[model samples]
Target: MTGPARSHTEAVAAVGRALAAYETQAGVAADAALVAARRIATDAAAAQADRQRHLERAEADLRACRAEPEARCTAEQARVVQEQHGLEVARRAVSMAERAVRDLAASRVRFRSEAAALITPGRTMTSVKGAELEAYLSSVGLRAVASAGPGSSSAGPVSAQRPSGGGGRDIGGLPEGFELVALDLVDVPDPVTGRDQFGKGYSPEDMAWAFSAFDDVVLPALRAGEGSEYFASLDAAEGRMGTRSYSDTYSGFLGSDAIVLEARPGGRYELSENGRHRFWVAQQTGRPTVPALVRR
Candidate 1:
């Protein structure tokens, strides 16, 4: 009975030891598999992070390339705008110059027309004789008849007398005793036939033409109160008055300033160049006693 019991116990102990050893080996294998799995996971995560960095770098390089072109485009646009502004300014200046030229040309044409119309042959007077002087006086609305002095007729030396109570000032460098006289009382000396007192190089035809132009054109302008304006327009167009001597005389007379005259050898007084235009205007418009500064 002792031997059988002893043998059973020994077999049972041996079986238990073998089973414990097998369990220990299985636990070590499971720990090694878990470590390997953790390493693989860490490596995969690191690779993914490196790929993301590469993508971000590529995007930054693309943005830099695009910015260079954009900057160049902005500079080019600014330059174009400045050039366009300069071109516009030049164009405007050219336009103004052209307009000024056109205005000057138009003014010259108008002046020429006015000068041409001034001296018509029919209205001009060549001499002062008989009723012609009286008719002219009447036409100018002068009631006073001219007094016959030492040389009353046209053939003899003419003297002009100042009317009583007709007060006047010395004008145009004439003598002090001279008084204002009607346009008809004073005779216009013919440039062709008589002595040219004013040194004007004009023929009788020219004188007559000038009178006609003044009467037809200048008188209406003066009566309408456009005298100053007309002169200004002419100046602006023709540059200035008095540049031409004859033109200056014309302007002076049209201005209605004092007319100067001198007594001739005969009873007739000679017309001064300064007063020619004024005298003509008075005659045409029937104005009496134009301001006259007479010289002996």
Candidate 2:
């Protein structure tokens, strides 16, 4: 929202491309995780069924054996015991599979929340006009296409439906009340602060490459642009930044919070987010400005 239209629009375009790629990647990944979870669940169910059948047969055989308590324990009794144990193990496996599927389902629900941060015109901006609307409408065009289905002449105004495109990482266009402004993450000069994830060091970006498409769009565009050392520092070679326990960017389709920024009394657009980690990462990576969605 600062700089000339050239940078803002260009920045918007870059973020747009990045978000589009991310949405694609997120969708594909969510689908894959679901498939994996379902497959495991199905396998677990089958195994449980098999074990149940074996246990039932074993129980039948044991019942058929009229064993005197003082005489001896028949082989059928031992078989029954083993089959019961097997059935228990199978039941545990089934339980674990079901749990994984549930977690994956929950992760998928947040995906839309993440995407809405950037594309959503918000409740306030719905009534505004001109470039802001134009830019919003433009971004909406990207998301609305795949969704609008064929024969739709045009994507309707964003107010027609809630926008959901960019992930929570970028603040392209947020809602109104507080002025929703686009700040180029790459252009933000000062080191922004949040809970530091870099003290022990950081994980390499490539690890995230496999999990998300941040690399596919943002990295390439930045590399092609002014060619800042910001990206040159990606710890691809070492496979890490430093000691780390948590997942890095793009580790999964974890529905993250938007990079919300509240203006301090000074009126400086330097305040900060629900997406604190993301904002910190952007500033650390030499990109705290362009892509951020902020409320002024």
Candidate 3:
């Protein structure tokens, strides 16, 4: 074969090899996602059971406290109230876990389907360009694959400037090579409270108010099949609380936003200001890695 023809054939062979490798990696990711989904479902079931037991115990304790003379029962009553608060938090966690299990399961199926479509004969190269594969992986709730070569698009590093006016510190307990980190790590100066704040920390009163609003307004609106107004009300409440709305965060996780991370001296990572509930959700779901924009 002539030199140019030989080069062309070699290039084609290289593309084929790369595609094969991507197919294998995608298959592995899909299998792992399914396994993770099953594990999450099992864990969520156990958590729900545990929460139920705790709630029963708390109820029993409260009843016992109430039976005591009013003067003697004051401290006991306070303790029981704390227990009830804990039970409520646990219940919320259980709900989150159950939702994660469902989302992960659905994502596993979608990942498998998309991967299959990508690798099937004659469909492989269609619209395969910058960040499409990474975007698809993210859409299916899998970690973005690192680029294999120059031409392939990947989640590259972020800019070097440190975010302003926060208690910037590295967070521990992340799995090795974890790509996503919590936005709560970025301590922004709170305008209202005049303290360094990351995410909104809810007090008992805050929790009470949120739950009351949810039950009275949001829940009824949702049940009545009011869509936009329900969401708008929710957004207003979340804004007042200074927290990202759960639905917004949920959609953000499935989208293609780059998670910016800073590498510390001891190989730790600090999530940037842009990260929020997605990192927290990743931790809740026990995800091993996520797509990130590392700061060099």
Candidate 4:
């Protein structure tokens, strides 16, 4: 009985040893599982942190994108304002240029109007007859302004034929380098009546008035030291036949280059060129008289 008890105790001890070895292996495996779980937890935490940073950056970029359109709109508005200002400046310049042109045109018109009024004399006439005035004017060694008809020759006969008085032919006495020109038809008086269109008669007073008007109004307006041409036609009254038979100072004969003798009615013989160049007179001798009058 003692041997049987001893063997049983040995078997029990062996079973105890096996159980302890199994327990040790199980503890090692539990420790390895705990380390693996900690590593997995740490990896998951790092991945979550990286995701949060990415989300923050994306939100900031979205805010900047939202503001971009407003910035562009503000720039566009500024450009439009600049363009409007430039257009306003151009319009103002054009208005100013137009005003300057109008002012210059107004100045020119005023200058011409004042000049014309200053040169012509103001006169009024009533019952002024053309032929009667012409006859009166002619008696004072004056001639009326003649009209040259269109088809009439310039060098042809320049006189009208009256019934008597040697056909009343008058000669033209134009100075050198000047030609006779006719006045406008409206300004001429009627031939039969001695009146103008205004029914005014021309008298010696009128002639004197015209001469004075020329001296006062016309001559002052002329350039300094300039000369003008004047013509006169004279008439002889009836019963003044002795003085009526007028003779030109050069009626006898004239040469292109010869000096002639002019005999005055007051018992004195003088030398002249038909009232032109009449300063020297000689004592009735046929000595070639021009050499003495050379103005030396």
lDDT of each: 0.43, 0.44, 0.44, 0.30
In angstroms, the error of model 2 at 275 is: 34
Best by lDDT: 3
Residue-level lDDT of model 3, residues 1-296, one tens digit each, is 33443344334445644655675588678678767767866776677677667667767777787776753666556766776777677677767777877776666555644553445331223213323544444455653334333122331111111222332322122223333333444322222231233346643333334333332233223322344443444454334323234333222332244356675564455666444443444344443334445564
Residue 108, candidate 2: alpha-carbon lDDT: 58
Q: Show where candidate 1 strays beyond 4 Å.
A: 1-202, 235-296
User: How well does model 1 score by local distance difference test?
Assistant: 0.43
**lDDT (tens digit, per residue) of candidate 4 on 1-296:** 13433343333333333333343344445445555555545555555455555555555555565578644454445544554555455455445544544543343233322331232221001001222333444565554443222111121221111112211122233222211111110111122232232223333333333334322222222211212211011111111122121111111111242233332343233333331121111111111111111110
- Mark the regions of model 4 whose C-alpha exceeds 4 Å error after superposition: 1-70, 115-296
Q: Ten-residue segment with the worst summed lDDT in candidate 4?
A: 230-239
Backbone clashes for every candidate come to 12, 14, 0, 18
lDDT of 1 by residue, 51-82 (tens): 44544555555555557854445444454455
RMSD (CA, Å), each prediction: 51.4, 14.0, 23.8, 58.5
Better candidate by TM-score, 2 or 3: 2
Model 3 off-target regions past 4 Å? 1-11, 66-71, 122-296
Q: What's the CA RMSD of model 2 in angstroms?
A: 14.0
